[model samples]
Each structure stands twice: as C-alpha cells, then as structure tokens.
Target: MTSELPPLPDTPPPAPTEPPAVSAHVPPAPAARRLSPLAAGLIGLATGAAIVGGTWAITANSGPDAPATFTLKGSFALTDSVVPDGNGGCGGTRGYDDILEGAGVTVYGASGDVIATGGLGNSTYDGDTYDCTFKVAVPDVPKGERFYKVEVSHRGTVQLSGKEAENGDFGASLG
Candidate 1:
C-alpha cells in the first residue's frame, strides 16, 4: 500500500498584530528652540551693563574709605654759612639746628587742617651755593584740596597749589 503527503500552501504566513514585548512606544522629541538676533543682543547688553555697574559700585564705595593721597616731597634749604659736622652732615649756629635731621615736616590742607606730617632727613651742605639742604617728605597727604601749605621746623608755611604739591615740585628757602 502507498501513502500520499499533503502539499504546502502557496501564500506566506501573516505578520504579527501586536507590538514586540521588549520595547514600549515612545513619541518623537521636539526640535530645539533658538533665540532671535535682537533677543541675543539685548541679553549681551544686559550682561555688560551688570558688570559695569558692579565695578562702579565697588570703586565708589572704596573712595570714601580710602581717600586719594599723594606724597609731598621737597627740600627745605637754609642759605647760611655752615660747616660740615664730620658725620657727612651740615652744622650751623644755634637756632639753625632745627633744619637738621628729625625736623618736623607738616602738610596743611586748604582749610588750615593738618593733612600729614613727616620729618626732614640729614642736612647736606652746599658750600658753592651756601645752602644747607634738608629733604622733607610728608607722605599720605590727602588730595583734592585747592592748595597745600608746607612748614618745616616751625618755619613759615610755604603755599603750594594742588598740582604743585601733588607733583612735589615746591620747595622752601630761608636766608
């Protein structure tokens, strides 16, 4: 006896109706937004203004705490016959000792208030010019005054303009 096998179907099988079990359905991401040219420019301008404002505030606050100052430096010369004191300094008669080292140097402001004080350095005798020169330096003198008055060792004050005092271009002379 002979047995007959059934023939295969002509069409292919159908696709699956349900999604895969491993992954869930997700929506597409939205596109990135961009700022307009005018918006970008405004933002930059605002940032720059903030920085400038901060800097101005800092400088303004510090101005009062530490006022502007300058060093008042000049020479006080006594035109007299002086001899060398063997110590590389000048020596003169009584009452002339005031121009030597440690002499008080005072700087007065426009309102007659003392701004700063220092002392004279060693005296140098210039025999050629007959001048005993003493250097004076009054440091940290407050600025912004219309004029400055400098006095050395109780001597009469020498008036100087603000520009002259700040530049240290003024000097005192006594005969």
Candidate 2:
C-alpha cells in the first residue's frame, strides 16, 4: 500500500539585484603636487655640484690625515766594469763609465732601516759626466735631526755610496 505526503507552504518573492552605490559625503581623490621645470633644474644642479665638490676635495688632499712624505734626492754614475771598494762595491776611488743608468737606489733611516727606493731619473749627459737624479718619498719619518744613507747599486755586486750620506740635506757624490 502507498502513503499520502504533506503539501508545501506559501513564500515571499525575492528583490532584483543592482551595483552598489557610493556615498555622496565622500571626497574625491586628490592629484599629486609637482615642481616646475626651473625648480627641478635648480635642484638637480645643486645635487651635481655637491657631489663634484666632495669628490674633488677627497682626491686633492689624498684624504684627511694622510701620512706626510719626505723626499730624498740624489745622483750617481755607473761603470762598465766592476771595481773594488773593499765592500764588494764601487764606492771608493774607482772611476765610472760614461753614465750610470738603471741603478737601484735605496735610502735608509737612522736605525739602518730602508725608507724609500727607486731607479735613477732625470739623466743629464754633460761633457765627461753622466748624471741622473733620483727622488724618493719617505713616509712616517719623524721630525728633528735624522741620519739618512743613500746607496746606489747595480746587479747586487757593484755599488756606490754618497759622500754626505748620513748628514743634512746634502748632495751625495758617487764613489
């Protein structure tokens, strides 16, 4: 046998849909403020000037608190053959050849420590003398009286010593 079912109840109808509306009291979005062409150009010019000035100062002074350098100036001659100065060098009464070139010169401090070294430069060829001057920058040398020795050597076998090697700002002669 079949059973009977209950009937459904009545219901209300639904409303139609639409896009949401914005409020009238809300303000509109504002636009971004911009500088004029002249103002922008001036600002860029100032920035460039500042950067250039800073770089120039850093380069010109070699940085603040850089060590003070002292220069040791000298000259010498070279011989074609080796001579004896009793110290495996040509620092005595030995005669040199036409000119001395490519000689390694080293300057030492008061404590017998090497201060600076370089090759001879500014060669001037006179009548019977071949001369060259060397300049070396010695750093961290304390102020006051100090002794300096300049040795001009070649091939580690023959060399020459300055005349006033351990004294004032004197010019040393090659032996």
Candidate 3:
C-alpha cells in the first residue's frame, strides 16, 4: 500500500533582528598574591623595633610615684613534697635557695625612677590555704595609688612547686 504525504504550510514573514551592544568600560584589577618575603621581613622588623622603642620610652620617662607598692599574692605548690612552715617561714631543707615559687612586682619611684622587684613564697601554710602578700615598696614616692606587675616563678630544683599572686589593681593600678 502507498502512503500519502501532507503538503507544507505557507511561510510566515520574518521577525526583526537587532545588533549586539558594545561598551568601553575598563575591567577591574586582579587580586595580588601574598606579600613578598622582603616586604614581610621588613614589616616584622619594624614592628619589633617599634615595640622595643615604645617600651624603652615608657620606662625611661616614668614619673615619681609612677609605680608604688607591688603587692603579690598567690598559691604555690611545693615540689619538695614537704609542707610549708605554716608560719610564713617557707621552710624547706633547701634553705629557700631557690625562689621555688615567687611573685614579681615592679614598682616605680618618684623622679622617674623605675624599679623591678618581686616577692617570694606565696602559697599555703602547712597544707592550709594562705594568701601570700608581698609588697615591694617604691622609695621616694610622691604618693598615690601606683601601678605594678606581678610574676610567678617555679623552681627547677628538687621542689616541684607553683605559686600565685594578684595585684589589688590591674597593671595600671597599685597593689
């Protein structure tokens, strides 16, 4: 059997076509990689120098009574395994040769004289808790609540100990 084919329809009119648009705007710049080694080193050196210079400047120009009494308080664990004197003696056969545990207090006197000093043995008394209070008085002071710093040191000797102390105020205040 032969199959009959359908006739094609009449062609419709063509639609309009527009031209592509163009612009003259500049492109954005590409991002840069990490800084060069030389640049990084210079920056690091500059930062270190600035820190050192600032520290020196501050220390050199402190006024009288700038830092007063440095009060240190903290608990220290004895490494010797021997208890404390229970009488603030900080007793040990070692004769307290080592700081074992200590609190550092930095004080400044009037006249722009800065002093770094600290205290020792701030811990419990005979197994009982104790508040170690160490005061490094700054001489020739004008008078006011002065600023101070506290540091603790643990001995590397036979004694395995630790200590703690806190200032009445922050580094900017007395205590």
* Highest TM-score model number: 1
TM-score to native of every candidate shown: 0.60, 0.36, 0.24
lDDT of 3 by residue, 1-175 (tens): 7597787679976887887777778898898889999999999999999999999999986756544333433333433534355555442334433433344433333333444455443444344543223223222322342333233333321111112122232211111
Instruction: Estimate every model's Cα lDDT from 0 to 1.
Output: 0.83, 0.49, 0.42
Q: What is the lDDT of candidate 1?
A: 0.83
Candidate 1 residue lDDT tens string, 1-175? 6597788999989987987587666878999889999999999999999999999988986764678888888887878656677666775556676667787888899999988999987788776776687777778999899999988878789999999999988788876
How well does model 3 score by local distance difference test? 0.42
lDDT of 2 by residue, 1-175 (tens): 5597676657665688887987778676798879999999999999999999999988997766744554444344432333333322332123444224445666665667666676555444332332333332323433332455656553222222332332224344443
Q: Residue 94 in model 2: shift from native, Å?
A: 10
Clash count of each predicted structure: 0, 0, 10
Candidate 2 residue pairs that clash: none
Model 2: residues >4 Å from true position, as ranges? 1-64, 77-99, 128-145, 154-170
Which residue runs of candidate 1 sit more than 4 Å off their true CA positions?
1-65
